[model samples]
Target: MAVSLDMLSLLPDPLLIIIISLLPFKEAIRTSVFSKSWCNNKLFKLTTNIEFNELFFVKSYQPSIKHLQRKAFLDFITFWIDNNKESIIEKFSLKLSMPNNVSELTEKCIAFATHKGGVKHLELDFSDPKWVEYNNVAPYHKFHEPMFALPKHVYDELKGIQILKLYSCRFVEKDLLNFHALKEVSFGWMEVSIFLINSLISNCKMLESLSLKRCWNFSEFYLRDRNQKLKKLVVDNCSFQYELFRVVAPNLKFFKYSGMMSYFDIKGCPQVEVADLDFSTEFGFGGKGYRLYNFMEDFYSLKVLTVCSYFLQVIPHGSDMLRMERNFNIRHLTIKTQLNKSDYRGIVFMLRSCPMLQCLTIQLGCARIWPNYAQPFASAPKNFWTENVRIYECLKSSLEVLEVKGFQGFDKSEIRMLAYFIQSGKVLKKMTINMEKDIILSCNRNLDLNPRKFAEFLLKVPRASTDLEITIC
Candidate 1:
């Protein structure tokens, strides 16, 4: 029952189309007039949600779609609300690109959804830049304000929204408290101002989950209150001021992040269950001050941990890896890095740290480079870790399920690393050598290490009782 110009030509007559589209139960009456053979209530009912995806494009000569005139936009919106006044929309969405300056059309859509109380899920996608480029949308100024940057009276009409998602749309402090029942909020690639941050804390009282990904400018966030019923919080890939992990959510069940020079200062929430902290360490950060050590204090109840492997050359200055001995309650640990250099501190950290550490999947690299000052790792001072990584022979004590992705040759460093795992992980169940094809081709073409020989050397490593699995891709 799509309303289209061709719909009239497809049917027998104009009067039939008018009866089919404009009247009450118009479809039923139209089908009755169409010899009764055209009756299909199930199809029409099912198609009710099938919004006409009326996509029109002008390729050769881009049609300057007459700018959505203010009057027409308002009238069309008013008509929709007037018609569906009794119907409560479950999912309300609008993707019309109103001329950049005239945000009134956009405002009307928001106002309509606001007055309509049944909107449970709402999505307002600002059109993609390329689409605008193709369409020749003139005077297209970027949106750097909240989706509904209207006056208070405008927002007064909006209420009862649950899940609100805004992508690439700026949000101001005032936009925070607009939705009283807002549960889940997602802001992608948008700037979050300090004022807006505080507003969210005070306003979004029932907010259960919040994710700010790639949205930048504000860094080092401090929650206004620690106990805001929020269960999950995720902040990833954003460039913000370096702040220690300072979130006080006693009810927070999950906190995940992927960033630089960061640390977590959890408020001891027993509810936090899983943390995907791909946090960088000193080694991961080219031997900087401390690789987000302040974060070691988090995860009192963390059950899952995924750590990025340190770059193999940068040596940590202090007792870098030792401090991590007791912090993690990880039952599953995935370490991503290689023994590109004789990074003993890193080796020991991955091999030994997790006392309760069970499932271990090591995405290691074969490219090895030892520090010029590096003698046997143990020769370094007690404060100087990587002193003797042979101690990794200790990992065999409890580690099981070892998956080494990006495996290359059995270089001396890798042999040493592998030997440690074979000896230490006595309880080891399965050891896998996941090698990439590029590694073999690179060795053959660049490093000149015979792939077959290197692989054979790795296979011969002594694993007392552990079953080994080698997979090359």
Candidate 2:
């Protein structure tokens, strides 16, 4: 009695499918070749991720593949399905980079997905203009919506696809008319209407995670309809007013945004416990107009907060940022510096306010702004980075494990700050720097000291209070 493929697939799941993809095909399908019931039907159960990327290379472009030929790329997908029941396919991704055949390929893909069952996750990306359309500029407004034809019954037909990710693809208002089952959606392009996006989300009963990046066309998009099922959302580099997120996701757990849209009204997301914010504005941050005190009200359950910002140009002085007077209740906080000078004080204030903050990552840098025209320069450059060391020194009280990056060897201000950390960083558990040993000892210099004395000086610190680790990188 020959044990058949059905026996091999008797205990099959996502893990088994992944294991099968890794094995040599001949050996992988040996169970199928053994017997009949173990035959074609059950062999494919241990399978997932059918990628048709092989059908799209530049050197030998398959002309008939896009023409819907009997043996086209989708045909291969159909053959794979016909040979076995692909009930295990969780993610069906297609990234074709051929020239001017995206529409044809797109049509076949949608047809295969609609006709074939079990495709719950789909990532359809035609980011390159050459593959999508033969023009110099892609018709960004039309790709995604057209990928899957406007069906008469989208809710009924697409009841399976849970996660939909489209990059450089178009999403029309009518597309969302049927995407009620969609749980997570991430999309990017030059222009996407917020009104259209809102209409889509309004109808998305099960939609959860929404990430929009670099979409400058329409500025104001609001997720204020607090009754929806959206749990996590991230908006990046879009110029919308701060009033959008005022309602807060009562059930939301993780909320993050990176860009100049600083007017965030957090009163709404009362339930959001974790937030990652990067308000490193290129134009400037702070001014008498900025309402930074709005943050003082309450974030009762906020356990983790990450703040990334650029040089503060308009930070409200004497406010929470510089004064450390505000009250915050987070348990773990990380401040990654995307700012130069102006943004530094605000960050210092944020860390100080978080009396309960346990973990922190203070990085350095600024946000880049893309302008419609060339910028005009008139004023002399201000030295903002000169205060970076001082800011680090300010953080010595709470920071237990300090990791510094982008360090230059032997700068006086930097050394002074390090010296302060060596002595005043009493709470520090470990110090990690990207400089060599010579650089570390430069902090405590003796006029006639050798390397041995320098090493000795470091050995007598407060019971290994300063555990120094140096690396070239």
TM-score of 1: 0.60
lDDT of 2 by residue, 1-473 (tens): 97434554555455555766555443555555654544655544455555555334333346564455423654565565555543445566665533135455555555555555566777665554443321112112233322233233333556667887765555445655576677887775435677666765677767788887655555455555445577888876554533454444567777877655344466666777788865544443324223545553445568777765432223333344353344566766665543333344555566556656555554432233322212121221143232333433334456566555544433333433345556655466766554333533443532243435444554554332544442224
Off by over 4 Å in 1: 1-117, 124-158, 217-220, 241-245, 262-264, 267-271, 278-291, 310-316, 319-327, 342-344, 364-394, 406-424, 432-461, 466-473
Say which candidate scores most in TM-score: 2
Clashes of each: 14, 25
Q: What is the C-alpha RMSD of each candidate to the true structure, in Å?
A: 11.5, 9.4
Model 1 lDDT tens row, 1-473: 97435343355543453444333333333355344323432222211111111122212233444233434544555565555544434555554433245476566556555564556666565534333221111212233433333335434544676777665554444655778787887775457764575567568787888887656666576654444688888876555576554677778887787665445567555568777754342223334324444344445466666655432223233346443535467677765665443455554554455567677776654333422334224433222322333444335455666776666654555555665666556677677766665755654634435767766876777765545454433
For candidate 2, report its TM-score: 0.64
Error of 1 at 157 (Å): 7.4
Looking at model 2, residue 403 earns an lDDT score of 59
